[model samples]
Structure formats: C-alpha cells, structure tokens
Target: MNIAEVSKKYEISADTLRYYERIGLIPEVNRNKSGIRDYTEEDCRWVEFIKCMRSAGLPIEILIEYVTLFQQGNETIEARKDLLIEQRKQLIEKMENVKKTIERLDYKIERYEQSVVTKENELKRTDD
Candidate 1:
C-alpha cells in the first residue's frame, strides 16, 4: 500500500511514519519504482508494533534500542527478551499509578457531587 493508505490504516501521520523510518524506529520501508513508499506486510507489522508500543508509553529511545537489537539477528534474542521484560515491568508500574490516579479522581468527583446535592437540598428546604 501507499503511504497515505498506510497512514489511514494505521491512524498515523505520513510524516510520522517517515520520521520513524528515518530514525530507525522502524525498518526501512520499500519504495516503488517511482520512489513512493510501498508498505509490505512485514513493514506494516513493524508500524503496528511501534504504534502499539508507543501508545503503551514505551520510550522511543528504548524502542530504538530494541529495534537495533532485533536487526542484529538471532544472537540477540535473549537480550531482546530481557529488554521486553524490563519494559513490561515498567509499564505495569505505570498502569498501577494510573489506576491509583483514577481512584483519587473518582473520590474527588464523588465528593463534589455529594456537596452539590447537599446544597441543592438545603436550598429546597429554605424555599419550602
């Protein structure tokens, strides 16, 4: 597919895709005879993987190192696994913090709602 199609399909900007390619965050994308990008299934898979990792809050520097290790062939398998495991641990911690934040927000919102209801009820009693 063309860059535009890939962009729409992946919900990413074409410029961002080019930037990923330029920065080696993704492997090189093949271009047609006209020098336009033609995304293969493998390339698309890389794009999807990068996007997913990015959405999960993985740092670009870490991803770049991961991709570099991935390109080094089979010898780096163990190292890559270790890297992923470490990143997963970080992501889990981040998720826990986010959950705590959500709970705090919920508590605050509930308090505000209760206060509003109490004031409304008090106003109604005064009007009665």
Candidate 2:
C-alpha cells in the first residue's frame, strides 16, 4: 500500500504519518522506485498500534522511546512492557479526573437550569 492508503486505513493524515517518521516515533518506511512511500503489512500493523497508543493519550516522547526500543529487538522487551504499564496507570488516573470534571459540570448545569426556572416563575407571578 501507499502512504495515502495507509493514512486512509488508519484515519490519520499523511502529514501526521510523515511527522511520526521524522520524529522517530515510527521506523523509516521503504520507498519505491519513484521515491514514494511503499507501506507493507508490517508497517500497517505498526501504524495501527501507534494509533491505539496515541488515542489512549500516550505521550509522543514515550512513543518515540517505545519505537526506539522496538527497533533494538528482544533485549528491550521488559523495558517496553514497563513503559506501557506506567503509561496505562497515568491514563487511568487522567480518565478518573475527567470523569470527576464531567460530574461537576453536570451538577453546575443542573443548578443553573433550576435557577433560571425559578427566576422565570418569579417574573411570571410579578407580571400577573
């Protein structure tokens, strides 16, 4: 597949893919005779994994480290696992904080609505 096809399959922009490559977040892709990117199944799989990690809010610096470790082969397996575990813990904490924020916002919105209704009722009574 080409870069465009990979981007379409992953729902990421071509610039993002290029940036990932440039930033060492992904391995260098092969090029065809025309110097265009030639993506293989392995590349596609890597892109999908990267996308999943990114969607889960993994930091780009960590991702670049992960990719570097991956390129270093099996000796870094334990280190890679540790990175993922740490990131997972952080993501979980972030999700909890977001939930708390959402709950607070919901409460505030409900209180505001109630206040509006009460004011409208008072106005109606005064007008009558």
Find the candidate with the highest lDDT and give its number.
1
What stretches of model 1 exceed 4 Å from their correct place? none
Candidate 2's C-alpha lDDT? 0.94
Candidate 2, run of 10 with poorest lDDT: 40-49
lDDT of 2 by residue, 1-128 (tens): 99999999999999999999899888999999999999998988889999999998888999999999999999999999999899989999999999999999999999999999999999999999
What ranges in model 2 sit over 4 Å off? none
User: Model 1: how far is 12 from its true place, Å?
Assistant: 0.6
Model 1 scores a TM of 0.97
Worst 10 residues of 1 by lDDT: 28-37
Clashing pairs in 2: none
- Report the CA-based lDDT of candidate 1 relative to the real structure: 0.97
Candidate 2 differs from the real structure by a C-alpha RMSD in angstroms, to one decimal, of: 1.3
